[model samples]
Target: MASLLLPIAAAFLLLRVILSATVIDDLRNLRPPPDFNSTIARNCHHNPSLRYCGNSRPLDEIFKFTIVASHLCNESRNPNCVESFDKIDLRGRPKIAPLYLSFDFFWKFCPLTIRSIDFSNNSLRGEFPTSVLACAQAEAIDFSHNELSGDFPVERLASMVNLTVLNLSYNHFSECKLSESLVFRRFNSSNFVHSGLIPNKQSFAVKAVFLMIGLPVMVILTVGFIAMMCFRRRNLSLETPQLRHHFTTSMLKAATSGFSSENLEEKSDGVDIYRGILRDGTHVRIEIYWSNISTEGMRKFIEECEVLVQLRHKNLVRVFGWCDDQELRAIVTKWTDRESLEMWLIERAPPLKHRLKVLAGVMEGMCYLHKSWPQVGYDLGTSSIILSENLEPLISRFEFDGRNSSAKSKFVYKHKFGVLLLEMITDRGKMGDVEAGKAGFIEHIRTSFTANWQNLLDERIMIASTTMEQARQAIEIGLACIDHSANEQLNMDWIRHILLRIYRASCHVNGSPTHGRFDGDRDKRHKHGP
Candidate 1:
């Protein structure tokens, strides 16, 4: 009996040693050495259950989960799931069964490849997740009708150029100042109805002053007194010529014949543009902002005034003055008889020589603006370019925001200038097509040039072999300007030199006088023109 027990004990001891060795081998295989090269891999290696590594699940399963989660509709009854990876539109969902999203819940589960997110009318709550801003490829984001609170990060939002359509309306957001970037400017008052988004500095200052004073009675009296003084001073100053540049409400009323329908040239975006003649017989364009103008619109009107006041260029439309009386708010600018560039391009395509001359004038004006005031930027487009009575091109409208001016602004200017050049060569009525896709305007031009350069050229104008080389060079310069790489984009000075060279070459090829003589004659004619 003792001998049998001893044999059994020995067998148990051997089995225990084998099991211990197997467990040790398994642990060694499971725990890999730290991979310092990749932080994610290293983290996953240290903790095998990390979610980034699918929490021990297969990578395919993780990807599938992300895709499925992103498409899951918020509808309580029958959630319609979509399979799209780029855009997610869940607009006008039932408010009673609102989709309540938490930052962790969405970020951890949703697909990261989404480019456009539309969560409008979701009845979502909580502050907007800044983590979502890190999605560099996100283009259009609509968060309207949500119960979102806190300050809207306008500056951060503006940094993303890909983010075009941003809707933040009907939210419980607090007062926040918007940056003068195109992103913020694209949104109107409707995008911020319940949200406390201040429109202008004046309103913000007034609010700040009132808050600081705190004494309602004293603040009211002081504000009233200041307003009275300003009204009196404005009336008194109107007698001077310099001050008289700003037409009175009565004078504008008389000029427009009590805002008659005949005076109305165009009506756009709730504003009426009227053709008015001053007492001196000088024609002017008056843009009257009626009460229907939203707070955002009024802010834009003020911004326009501010930008126009600083600009002083022959090629630019002259802002004579503005009227901001109790009953009327209007902007007055010098009127031109010739049609807009869009109209001219569509109705009557000019000759190549004439187009080159107009383009040269535009480049000169752009060069001046770029050099003299690097802080100011123009939104160059066909509609912004107006033809004068002498058929000279005038940059009638521009965008200027000194606060947000940067190296990127220069690139934007160059890109728009490239679009202008494309417009010239193609004789296209609009630049919309060029700016429509991710391939870029330069890519579109290259594709067209590769397919058939002749087809890309304006068919209305016959090209002579003598100036064909110059046209090709001009196109090359334009293509270079719109290069995807910022380092490749030509500087304003270089662009000017190339444009001037092209103009001179065109002039010489057309049997016109040499550079200096022809320019001098043209300048004289322009200066003395009707």
Candidate 2:
């Protein structure tokens, strides 16, 4: 009994030594309430030292506790280290106790209360801790930019139903390529390189579409608005008066779900768009204007909106209605389940056939817009173009017209106009020498830039002998549309003929007899020897 009592006393003393060990209380002072407002800081790693310290406001005191488990953390021979719960940084400041024993102690602890865990940009080693399996509430995890090895255990990740954002950027995840089905479920690819996870074809296309189309168009509409101010001096007299559409600030707030962050789209010219669904089961895209709108310009914008709403061409985006009451002005268009054409194109693989099809639809739409309306210069470039389910092109945002009906003047106009046409032809608007031009009026326009198209062709369009001629013809039409002299520019009537000829050439190359179904008149013309 004496021996047993002595052993028990020894164990009790060991426990006391651990429990009585001094902890740096100042560290605990950094704890914040669990409800820190999260603003998605993109590419947060850009400034690696810029630490995002969480709200230092303390959580309920009851949530605070310390356990003397440091001795158990002695997995290595490093004698200086203490056994304790693993410390995880919330934002930048360290919180959550150090891991006791192996990191597996995480399973025994934080699986319940912790909602977000960010272990990014650290020298964290080992495979992703399987202990996270117990984290039912773990919705967002940032394990990117770490020294983690091994394949991305996707099977384990997919099990986390609550996970909304999984950032796995800057890690050695190369062997673990993710499926299209996987990325489709995940939203943001915050730092997707080095993951070795090539997204499947469909996902690649979708992601490309989002980046290429969504980003470029957004940048153009945004930057073009500013760049276009330079042209204002030339067309000062041609400015149209905006129409009035007024709405109260209260109505605007209600429509936008109190201007929630989730609804927010791109911010341009002090305008914020919210993905708003109206009470009438109508999908209303809400755009809140911060800049001043002249009454005449507003009126003209409304008239254009109304005009577009009336048209039902296959390649045209249908506008439902506009609401301008109080301080809000919103336009309701038909809700497309598939996001945008730009988004679609950005994520898709390089295919000449698909590119041709997209151009053809856009050309058909432009033909209708210019010819059917007469005197209207359907300015369907850049931001105005969209894509459909079959990857067909659909034009949008045609409300803002240049207000100039006459032919363009000066070489600079020719260059800008040429770049615009090049985008339609090559599907790559990343302008370079082809757009900048060398010398003279012809050089400023695309008509003189045949060499540029050869360079700018998206590498995805495989160099197939079959599709070369059709692609060349398409390029020719784009050049024709942006002739140096405005009078030299082919009319839409003639442009449509060129487009049909290109389409016919594509059909011949592919030997696709089904092409006739798309154009009964073309089939008739062929039969009647056009």
RMSD of 2: 32.0
What tens digits encode model 1's per-residue C-alpha lDDT throughout 278-372?
Answer: 89998999988776566776677665665565668767788788886667788888998889887887788676666666777787778677767
Clashes of each: 0, 43
* Model 2 spans with C-alpha error above 4 angstroms: 1-255, 294-302, 337-346, 372-379, 400-421, 424-456, 463-466, 485-489, 523-530
Query: Taking the tens digit of each residue's C-alpha lDDT, what string does model 2 give over 1-530?
Result: 11222233335435555765533333233232233122112212233332222323222221222221222222222354432223333322222223321334334444244456566765566676666555656777777777677766677765688888777777665454336436434656545655556444676799899898898889989898887887875565456312222334565567668888977866777777777665556666665666667898678766665565566788877665666554556665655656554554466653555556666576567656544543334444455576657766677665444433333421233333344445544534444534443233234335435555565455555444446666666666556445455425445444545556666667666776555424643632311110
Best by TM-score: 1
Scored by lDDT, model 1 comes in at 0.64
TM-score of each: 0.48, 0.43
